[model samples]
Target: MIFGKKRFPGAVADFEKAVRAQDGDAAQEAFARLHRAAAKAGDGELREAGPRLATLLPSVPHGPRAAVAVVIGACVERGADVSACAPGILAGARETFALAADFCARWADTGGGELPDPDDELTEEIIERAGYEPAVGWFTLPQWEMASVAVLNDPAVRRESAGTAELLALVERVAEASDHEFRCLAYALRVLDDEPLVVLHRDTGTGYALRMSGIGDNFQLHTLLAGVLIGGKHLPGQAPSPQEIAVCRDAPGQVETVGSFNLVGPDGTWIFNEGTPTDIPVIDGARLLVLDPPPYRRAWPAGRFFPGMRGDLVLDRVLDAAETAAWFAKVQPAKR
Candidate 1:
């Protein structure tokens, strides 16, 4: 009967009532409606509603807790201050739904307090013990999703089929010219393609491609790619020489060098000591060539990279030339 009625406050009240009564069905319906209402609400309204909904978390039924957490996550995405909700969110995390807990933890404000190192490990163990399914659809999370769709749509990110063919031919020629089968790890940042990719080559003819969309920055991307090459058994017949291991082990912690490498284009333009592979411009047919020792020693912490988690790296598949070209062609890059 009321004209221009505000939906957020009313929705919040209904949600709180459902939680208080521990009515799972009603809570679910209420949360869905609340989520829709939240989408329409202004930032100021969301900021006000966030703390109110957080207070109801302790009373929320276990069955509906994850749904509530999702709502809270949306609130945080819209500039809501829900720092007061950390204790309740962490509590629910300890109780159940570890996957959802991990998602919610990103939004929780810790007041500049670091989690005790041992307790942090114990919590990770508990989450592992929960046996949650692997997280997928990483692009759904705001943080994981590319900040600028315009960047992803840029034409420079797309490589022409002719360029890809040339790159394959170049790899073949290099392999034929070399003594050992060509093998190395390479990374490509095609922002228009949505995810940055790391290709691990056991041999020149074939390679495994992993989507590293979850990597936070270029530095993390370099570090993780290096870690995977070193720690993993990607090099089949070739074992790292003792000198190679010693060099990696003795390298200074903050050294910027990612070993000796050449950055080349399919057209034969080459540069040396320019920077890490990641620093290369996003041009069609550009490549980073690491022709030195095979990576077979651990140079970074193992636990830093989370496989199959949201906003973390996930293995895509093994790809040869044609398959790789097909994958690249699937997404149409934005034209200039």
Candidate 2:
């Protein structure tokens, strides 16, 4: 157990004390100190509490969850023998209430639950592959789940009113696309709530708008644009291969062709402003694509405000990069 009854109770006690003090600033400071100590604990008493800490994580609220996640991440970062605890840590961080509820209930019954057998060998591989970092790991789990849940709740895209199957598929596809699955999930989450979409570039002379989706998810824009550029005459579900994506990206402006650009619904209903017609095949479910520019342009000048959380400056940083575009394209659905 990482933080059993007999070990490292002082750290947990100090954290709980600060939390009960009702002073947000002091609690934040306490969390910071806890993280520092956990990171430096190495193979000391705090390190010994790893397994217990994993099961203990889910029973707490958001603030302590953040602190505990940091401690677990620090253990993983330092290559500690936390193999027995990783699954619980991940489940706690992710709020798998079905799995964690029993752990929490049991903790309430007896100060700690039975330590699960260590699977550190496999869990360590998963953590390393996901690039777990103490700084971001804690925040990423809940945030990523939030983003995925929002997409499922979106009426236009929901496969069913419940949307559970669609949500799981979304998570799986996103993980497959990203080198760091958790990091990608957090990025996806932020864009859903905070950065929906914005016109990153506009033509002053023509009054045309070129918008990009905020964060890369199934509805990401870059892949659709690349598919249009390379697979011009194909219809109904042809996506660009990586090599083809590269070709389209290398010269995006040059690939602009005769067909209209669109953001379409699952039913083929247009979401974005309509564009010009052409020989390009209409992909019935294409969510975000560009063949031609949008008819309306932003009234404001370039670099002007968009009346949202993110500024044009932030959009510029994300949209203008080839690597970002590549990553975004990977997360988007191949067909729609």
Candidate 3:
């Protein structure tokens, strides 16, 4: 060890030993040691050691991949020319993100964390140009939907530059942190809201088609819910009438076949695509209807994830809930 601290090489060597023995705890400890060492080391020292470090990244467990990438992100942040190490970093990132996608898919019925195919020509092109600012659109997002999700969940990140370093920073922050699954959806929603892709088609007069590219049937319903909630609040004029809200709720079903959405009206519940116009009777003084995602089925669910949760309250609760759930699940046994 150098100066009574485990230096980069020694830390990496310890990680390798942990990996060889398949000891996850030991591997994490070694990676922590390596991270601390990298932090203490200078830019030139990291840049000089880049090649070997990049090569070792893919071999490590997925849990530590972003932590390893953090070193690279920091190097890039500090303006180190990582051109020689970029290829290796990209290759490892592809593998790690794929593993992350699969891991997250296990939590939710529909969200597999959808990373783009790394082998695709367009993906390679984006990665090639990732050294530039425009790389924000494709490389960071398509590579891992979680990055998109993270961007959406955190308004700060969504509003900032979603460049390579920022994307890497998000992955590092979330991967081994907490609320792995919920945060992914929360973050993705923030990204989706800011994303230029969601074209609002007011063709139906009251409703709009939320055409977001990466969003599939799984997310289509949630996207629709988000659209209605967002649109109701920020429709630029008066709050949408109950009739307008009813139409918007039904719109997603016509567009996507997989999921169904509905709104609880003043008179009764109105099922999307199932009821006639007369069945969804209008109320003179009805507020925008509240709908919940499937399986939860909670009545008048206030926000996306919790009840009585307005703007700032919603953000805090959802984030705190997700983080708490993540921590709880880890310590307690699974229940039926």
- The per-model lDDT (C-alpha) reads 0.40, 0.36, 0.39
- Model 2 gets an lDDT of 0.36
List runs of model 3 lying over 4 Å from the truth. Answer: 1-6, 12-27, 79-81, 96-336
Our tally of clashes for model 2 stands at: 7
Is candidate 2 or 3 superior in lDDT?
3
lDDT of 1 by residue, 114-166 (tens): 32221122244333432222121111222111111111122232232123233
Number of the predicted model whose TM-score against the real structure is largest:
1
TM-score of predicted structure 1: 0.33
**lDDT for residue 299 in candidate 3, whole number 0-100:** 27
TM-score of each: 0.33, 0.28, 0.30
Clashes per model (N, Cα, C within 3 A): 3, 7, 7
Tens digits of per-residue lDDT for model 3 on 220-245?
A: 33334444445445333223334333
lDDT of 2 at 157: 26
Best candidate (score: lDDT): 1
